[model samples]
Target: MATRWGLCGAGKISHDFSVAMKTLPPGDHQIVAVAARSLERAREFAKKHSIPKAYGSYEELASDPEIDMVYLGVLHTEHWRLGLLVLQAGKNMLCEKPFAMNSREVGDLIAASKKSNVFLMEAIWSRCFPLHREVRRLLAEDAIGDIKLVKASFGSPQLHIPRSVEKELGGGALLDIGVYTLQFVLMVFNGERPESIHATGVLLNSGVDESMVVVMKFARNRLAFCFFSIAVSLPNDATISGTKGTIRVLGPMHCPTTLEVNGKTTQYPLPEPSLPLNFTNSTGLRYEAEEVRQCLLKGLKESPRMPLSESALLTEVMDECRKQVGVVFNQDSQ
Candidate 1:
């Protein structure tokens, strides 16, 4: 049986997700509907992706009895509200990164999912990539030997985008791109919470972080450093160093396809999509979609690869980071 998906937004990320979904085998996954604030926008997205239904409002989409899962791709600010609606409607959900505005919202969403007894996962697609899985395998085998240091950066000149800088929209480099670097570090340390976190950043007039540097210390004298920015372009690369050797993840760390283990380089090219995408290596999203399908097939309530606990931890860390850097969102006070 196919896992029917109802897209909750028609933005660029959602468009990329739709394109990636097409790359998967049609018999296993299906996008049955798409919803947007505007009916015309939803219709246009549906027409472009050949989805069977278009909804003018999220309520209508969530109410559809045919949708097996709802992919929440709306702005960061809307995640909590829309995610709650989906869970309350007795539907599974795959919410985009920075799952919610803050840790409190994430906790509420998790509680709602548990009460509803439905599958729920944060859409951090990188964790499901082949390269990432290989990295995990090597790490478990101690290929690098006791990870001691981790460094990663993800930055692009995105200040021109309204949603990237607006405070009300939950905009900032930390929540937008920094989460990738932080997640990379957490993956290396096996999801251990840092012993201490320190952050410094430049904020725009809008009170959102424009650029930031974060440093964390973990057990066993492990250290991780991350740099993220919206005003500046960065290498976007990540490196994990250990006592024995080093592992390097090539640029665009969030959706990477290349890796270097002890100076040996390998490239895992992305699947060729029939349509152009809005983000880099977005076709790789098929892996997460497939993971979701398999979990649903097995009657699982959460994905082990990107579990709910990890999502909660990520939000908690980001909350502390924001507090240190003085990046406050409207949702933070609620």
Candidate 2:
């Protein structure tokens, strides 16, 4: 049976998700509907994606009987409200990253998922990548010896992007890209909670972080350092140093397939499906989509790879990071 999907936005992220869905083998998945604020926009998206239904408002999409699940591709600022509405309508959801403005909203969303008994998962995507899975496997095998330090940096000149700098939209390097750095470190440490966190960042005129450096101290005398910036470009590489050797991610640490473990390089290619879409980033989204599909078919409410509790903990870390850097948003009050 095909798992029918209703895309909740007509934005770039939704477009990418639609392309990934299109590449899936028949009967595995189907994109049945799309909803946007503008009916014209939804119609255009449906036409481009070959979707059967289009709705001007989200309510219509949420209430559609045919859609078993929805991919909430809207901005982080709108996730909490729209997510509750979808759950109330008895629809499962795969929400985009930076799940909410703060941990409180994520807690509420988890509560709603429990009350509704519908599957819910955050779309971090990277956690499901083949390369990341391999990284964990190698670490568990003690290939890198005792892990001592992890360092990563991600940056781009994205000031022109409205969402990257807008205060109301949950802009800034940390929430926007720093989350990846933090997640990567946590994954390397097998999701160990840090004993202490300290962060410093430069804030834009809009009161959002433009660049930042974060240091986390963990038990077992381990440490992680992350560098994030939107003002300039960085190498975007990540390194994990251990007592015996080091593992270097040769490409974009967030989504790259190439890894150099103790000077032996290996590349893990994306799964068989080919993407014919504008956003190549969509290429990797398939991994998490498949994870979601398997979970749904098994009647699971949360994914083992990217669990709801981890999402809540990550959001809480971001909230504390924002507090240390003095980045506040209007949505934080809610």
Candidate 3:
């Protein structure tokens, strides 16, 4: 295996992932090609990363026989199609967050991936991070004792901004920031999907949810509550409390701002030139890409961290939460 990575969507996220891949152990990984909407953008991205090939379109990238895997950073609406294309073309794929528009879309991708004898996964980088992984370990070991309640949130003051709240683009706090919160809750619950949910939220003119508060109840009285807002903020982080102790995960908490066990808190010293959870940030993308590479080497089609089933259930949770909150987007009402 050449250990080469092909990138679809030479945008901020693909660029970030490329850079992060470079930081890996020498000879383990390399970005060989990139494809984008415009030829010039692809060329520029290739130049920036020293990639060997640049294509003017996604189909061109998907056509590369030498490419072993493709990382997709396209829009959420297009993930399903692009994923199927790559799978059919005989390449593994790691798509950006919100894996697909809904569970049905995810089912399509999953079936295609299996049919094509390849792999597929969601890039929920936060769940694969060292500390985030540690949190799960502690919970399973009962370091925190039997889990009780979970609280999490992620949002910014961007609800008023048109670009950040576009319904057509699948915008809104719930799908945008809230997905992360929901993923956090799901992880702490030991893979059990929520049995019942109660929610409330703010809707935008585009008919999308701008802010939301959700309470998810699982088996044995364990409850997880999440808050998301384009109107306000709440540490935009997470706290997992159990019988023995509590763990607090800080902002953009996927990669974690700070991870504390019990009363002692030790920050992991920020990466050089702080990386935000944006298309331009490589820190989180790097870990996710590495996980994909590792899983592939191990002959796994779905990652143990953020598998396809979880992505499917997570999508349903987000969709139903919106429904319960009486928030209907253009897509939903259609």
Which candidate should be chosen as best, given lDDT against the real structure?
1
Q: How far out, in Å, is residue 97 in model 3?
A: 0.6
Task: Please report the candidate that would top TM-score against the real structure.
Answer: 1
Q: How does residue 287 of candidate 3 score in lDDT?
A: 76
Off by over 4 Å in 1: none
Give the per-residue lDDT of model 2 (tens digit) for 1-334: 9888999999988888877776666588889999999999999999987899999999999999999989999988899999988988889999998888888888988899999999999888888888887888889899888989999899888999989999988899998889988888877877678999999999999999999999999999999999999999987879999999999886677777788988999987765435455543566777888888999999899998888878887888889899999998887776
lDDT of 2: 0.87
In model 1, where is the ten-residue run with the lowest total lDDT? 184-193
Whole-model lDDT values for every prediction: 0.93, 0.87, 0.80
Clashing pairs in 3: 12-279
lDDT of 3 by residue, 293-317 (tens): 8898999998999888888889889
Superposition TM-score, candidate 1 onto the true structure: 0.99
Is 2 or 3 the stronger prediction by TM-score? 2
Better of 1 and 3 by TM-score: 1
RMSD of each: 0.8, 1.6, 2.2
Over 1-334, each residue of candidate 1 has an lDDT whose tens digit, in order, gives: 8899999999998899989998888998999999999999999999999999999999999999999999999999999999999999999999999899999999999999999999999999988999999999999999989888999998899999989999998999998999999888888887888999999999999999999999999998999999999998999999999999999999768988999999999998989877898889899999999989999999999998888988888899899989998988878888
Q: lDDT of candidate 3?
A: 0.80
In terms of lDDT, model 1 sits at 0.93
lDDT of 1 at 242: 95
